[model samples]
Target: MITISNLKKIYNNVLVVNVPQLEIAKGESVGLVGNNGAGKTTLFRMILDLIRPESGEVISNGEAVAGHENWKNYTASYLDEGFLIDYLTPEEYFYFIGGLHQQTQAHVDDFLSTLTDFFNGEILKKGKYIRDLSKGNQSKVGIASCLLQKPELLMLDEPFANIDPSTQIRLKNMLKSMNKQHGVTTLISSHDLSHITDVCDRILLMEKGRIIKDIATSSSTLAELEDYFAVGQSATLLPQIDEEENH
Candidate 1:
């Protein structure tokens, strides 16, 4: 399980994200939703130990995560293009990441074996640098790298961006299967409410750098989500509608 206590991030002496407490149990699928600059990415980075929070603690599996020495062993994340290796080919990138994570070459081969039928041959045969590959293909490679490690916690930021609709559907199915089959806790951020509503068990709505609303999938819809981001309305409005529907 991952736990956060009084987490806060400050930029130029201004408060950004401040979560007094939050916890994600094992095998849970949670979606982080927000408008631009809502501190979603910053919070995610803190969870990955990529950036230090100004104060408070982020713990994973009973260990402090901010400077945890073994973070790579339990966490896998793909936040942006910065995670990609421009100079390496797709196959080489996989090997590199796997090796850094202490996975044997055979482990890489075994992991890719399952995905062999899923990917077209072109990505495997692309001898050129990963930077030369199309954006969609590159995203496929990045995702494949993260899954190769098979980490306990998977944090993905906008996993569907820049990919084709067909591939997006495929990825969604893959993630859903992973959650069900492996019980891997996943935290994904997306602007598309449909994506969150379709895959996530719970959703956290972030606005102006704070989580203003938290709702389970059984309690919400895409249209309601649209209104949440439209005018920065009060979250109390949601529960009232839910109450009215029950009556």
Candidate 2:
């Protein structure tokens, strides 16, 4: 449902994102793994039109992102806490997002109800503005609102961050159900390899603004992925440090 061609973004003479091509078909869940400055968020922002790419284009279902009037209808994205309206209550936030897609409050409520297991009762009943809630609760509201629209393409960055471990498992199950039940195309990015391995069908690794690895979960084990991902490469080198100290 999404395609990117020759996408490039540069800042201060440094290239941040430079994908030559990418395509995500319907009902596929892809995980993006990368270091802090690996340009995952930059790529996502360009796709969402939050930032204009210096060159190339983002297309969804044959429609260019820059001029697609129906883009919002097909795509729902949450990149950071800033996307949530600080003043809006959880109920108001869900309604607002659902209304953007021409959905009614009932639609939003129904969606939220299905996710009660994921929410753990912290979503709509909180007595204060979203900003007043804890970070984890705020994340629940943001993710719940994103799912309320039943979007075809859902782009979530660091969805597992700040969420508790138990709720993280709930979210993983929720995402799996969403893909299997609704055939939603999802693109998620995170530093947590475990979350990506458990939830995503395919994992794409990025380094220095380029895709370094893209592997299907069925084809590889997490330990092999850890070797590929170099999750604790620096830590593993500590033995070498010990040798040097002895020398």
- TM-scores vs. true structure, each candidate: 0.90, 0.89
| Candidate 1 residue-pair clash tally | 0
Q: How far is candidate 1 from the true structure (C-alpha RMSD, Å)?
A: 3.6
For 59-126, candidate 2 gives per-residue lDDT tens digits of 88889988667788878888988999989888888888877878888877777788877888776676
Error of 1 at 117 (Å): 5.8
List ranges where model 2 is wrong by over 4 Å.
229-247
lDDT by candidate, in order shown = 0.84, 0.84
lDDT of 1 at 87: 90
Clashes of each: 0, 0
| Candidate 1, 1-247: lDDT as tens digits | 9899999999988788988889899999999998888999999988888899889999889999766677668788889878998898888898899888888888888888887645666478757898998877777788888898887889999988888787778789988988989998999999978988788988888866677667788755676787766766646456665665589
Over the full model, what C-alpha lDDT does candidate 1 score relative to the true structure? 0.84
Model 1 TM-score, 2 decimals:
0.90
- Alpha-carbon RMSD of each model: 3.6, 6.4
